[model samples]
Target: MTAPVLEIALLQVRPGQTPAFEAAFAQAQSLIAGMPGYVRHDLQRCLEDDHRYALLVWWETLEAHTVGFRGSPQYQEWRALLHHFYDPFPTVEHFVDVTPGRLPPS
Candidate 1:
């Protein structure tokens, strides 16, 4: 079986837009949570930089995000609801766990 992939995005929201961005993200979360092959996700704010956020999403495969989600209509809605809050567009990347075994079960 293929290991899961993690999508990482470092988001720099416009100054003074954190609250709006966070509120929009709350609404947008459901769009991603319901996608096929989605494992889970988290959006964390930076302590040093309140305008910054780290978005981590785990998916069953890379295509589950690059194709399955990005190509779906929900992504358009996701973009519409949250895109404007960004300063410069965020760069998204995917990674697989490199350890001998993944994280221990909780």
Candidate 2:
């Protein structure tokens, strides 16, 4: 099946809260990694704007992301741990990878 593409936001925690945010994110990673159909994930820090960050997650299908992941217990943990880090929950969008690059080797 063709994979679904999702853009995730890595909420910018204020400077002093970096440690707290990282610690929580580290804890959530294990749970997220265990979910079904979860293909891969990447964390990126903004080079031009240090305060900004993002997560890119690819799934085997949209259901794998919205229903499988978002509705699972792991998602609860993921949200509880990470949601607060965002000053304002950044926007989330989905798109097709028409001219995609090489699939990342996990």
What candidate 1 gets wrong by more than 4 Å, as runs, is 101-106
Q: After superposition on all CA atoms, what RMSD does each candidate show versus the true structure?
A: 2.1, 3.1
Task: Give the local distance difference test score of model 2.
Answer: 0.75
For residues 1-106, write the lDDT of model 1, one tens digit per residue: 6668999999999998999999999999999999999999999999999999999999999999999999999999999999999889999999987887676334
lDDT of 2 at 42: 79
Deviation from truth (RMSD, Å), model 1: 2.1
TM per model?
A: 0.93, 0.81
lDDT against the true structure, each candidate: 0.94, 0.75
Candidate 2: TM-score? 0.81
Choose the strongest candidate by TM-score: 1
Per-candidate clashes come to 0, 0
